[model samples]
Target: MSNVKDVIVKLTDVEKEFDGVKVVKKLNLEVRKGEFLTLLGPSGCGKTTTLRMIAGFSNVTSGEIELEGRNVADLKPNERDVNTVFQSYALFPHMNVEDNIAFGLVEKKVPKAEIKERVAEMIKLVQLEGLEKRRPAQMSGGQKQRVAIARALINRPKVLLLDEPLGALDLKLRKQMQLELKHLQQKLGITFIYVTHDQEEALTMSDRIAVMNDGVMEQIGTPDEVYNRPKTKFVAGFVGESNILESYVTQVDEDLLHISLESGKALLHAPGFKNEEMIYICVRPENLLLSETKKEHFSIRGRIVEHVFAGSVIKTVVELINGQKLRVARHPNEEEFEVGTYVYVYWHPKKAIIVHTVEEQIYNVIEGTTNRIYEQLGEKYSPSAREDSHDQ
Candidate 1:
């Protein structure tokens, strides 16, 4: 865990509303200095909205956005000590890379000599040594992106806001740029708040990831923690390929949970839960093994529906008796298990990651079996009073 005092950017219950519709809920986040923090989620999940609010492009509906303990939520874009880089690589089409990078300094009316010196340093930092004369039209996608980054870094802002800056690059070049950007962040020791929907990119480039869904932050942690120990079903499904199983807890003893799985019962050692709770548990594809011979403590018989071979590994999709799909990933082997063959899916007891969340309230809402909502609203659910048309 990072020290709280090292925080460079903080958002406390920050919100955004457009046309009376809330896009970003009350979100609280702390970005440590010099760390690459990526806000990762699907489209329209309010990640870009969050970034815009931080960059002062979008105003916060309520709460505070602090930089170095000073609230700048209502500051203008130029008034804040931060810069933004977009996916479009919004560079001047007429200006060369050198002029584009020196735009900030020129606007500030800095000395020409100092501007030239700083632009040179920026070019070297982004490794655009001889491409200074190349314009946006003359440069490739990768080069233009570097130029844009160079322009943003020229100002030396306390935090750099990159909104899917690599979204326009090709796959090979995107992979290469991911490494370059990570290295650059490390070399400069500057705070980076990145936004991307690509999970692999987020895992590769981010020191920490904030997983968002439906305008709400689901989970925020390191890559391993977010991937391995997801706190919610949304995080589990979004972070990577996972097989989520719905189970009902029938008994709980300390850290041990006895759950009713499928038509059978199983014992899980995950801590924290209540009896009769409908919970979600997940396991990664690699953790699950498909075998013909069943010799395990826990195994579910399933039929192979499809197999995908992607060079390094083979993905086998299995359909269980309950119609739920499960996937298993492993290196290529000499196993001749064709599609439609029956196999057993099994994993160690501890491989299951029990999703711990407040979703029980949602389940209550769905089932319409709880009076908690009425209690909160200072009322009681007395359906029986209306059971007989105002009579006994």
Candidate 2:
């Protein structure tokens, strides 16, 4: 857990609706002072709606939003001490870089000398010093984005909201701006609440991430926490590449669970599983290793189906005897295995995470059983709960 002494913004039971259709539902979040928190999800996941609610652009249907300890739900966008940088840049076409950056201060009736000084400082902060006289038509995509960012930061708002500001840039420029924005946030010590559908961007720049699906928050944690220890199945599939396997709990001994897969039985180290309970086992591609022979505890036989040569790693797809396919990632320097080669897919028992097997499913396997992990153990078996046991 992080040592969050002060919360700059908080959303409690926040909800939104459009034409009687619910978009954002019962969202609870905390943004710590000077922390970079990102709301990440795919399109129509309500990430933008959440950001808009925070920025006071969209009114909440119910619940409370507090900024710096004051309820800001009733405040207008400008009344709240926050600025937004949209994906479109939103810069004036006729105005040059300095004028566009100074426009906000001018609207606030700031003194002439102070506005000039602040504008100059912001220009240098965003590395736009040399492009002061360049119009939006003359500057590159990167420069125009810097100008948008400078314009927003000139007022020194308590929090900054960015709605996919890098979406319009080319791939190379977007990558460059991700690092630049992170460095600028650290230097300024301003709280940032960013919204993006790009998983890589969220993983690359966020101090923490709140992953949402269909207007509900799936999980919120550090980048490593969300990526490595996802609480829900949606997060596991959305954040990164995961090979999920369906299995039933056959036996349990302390923290070790004996699960029966379609191909065979395997032992996994996890908690909150009862006998005959059905669950999904999530394993990252990088965690699966290829071996010539099967291991004692956590191994399965599979036949190589395809091999993709990614620049830094080779992604190998293997089909199990049960007709389920799993992806394994290996370093590029490792010896390659050809298609149709028989091999054993193995991973450490601790590398697998057990998820609740729900209905409405048509992917990997059928729902065979159920255990009241949550109802029986209360919060102890909640989705956010994690087992401390590891392979010894």
Write the residue-wise lDDT of candidate 2 on 1-392 in tens digits.
Answer: 33445988989999999999999989999899999999999999898888899888899999999998899967999999999999999999999999999999999999999999999999989988788999999989999999999999998998999999999999999999999999999999999999999999999999999999899887899999998888778888889999888888898998889888987778888975688978888999999888887787655789999999898989999999999999999998887888999988877889988654323332323322222444466766543452422222
Question: Which segments of model 1 are wrong by more than 4 Å?
Answer: 1-4, 250-258, 263-267, 274-276, 356-358, 361-392
Q: Estimate the lDDT of model 2.
A: 0.88
State the displacement of the C-alpha of residue 277, model 2, in Å, after optimal TM-score superposition.
1.6
Worst 10 residues of 2 by lDDT: 362-371
**In terms of lDDT, which candidate is strongest?**
2
lDDT of 1 by residue, 1-392 (tens): 55768988999999899999999988999999889999999999999999989898888999899988888956899988899999998999999999999999999999999999999999989889998888899989999999999999999999999999999999999999999999999999999999999999999999999999889998899999999999888888889999888888888888877777683355567875689988788989988877798743455778899989978989889898778888888788747578999887777768888874546535645646444443445533454333343585
- Candidates in order have lDDT scores of 0.87, 0.88
The collision pairs in model 1 are none
TM-score of each: 0.88, 0.89
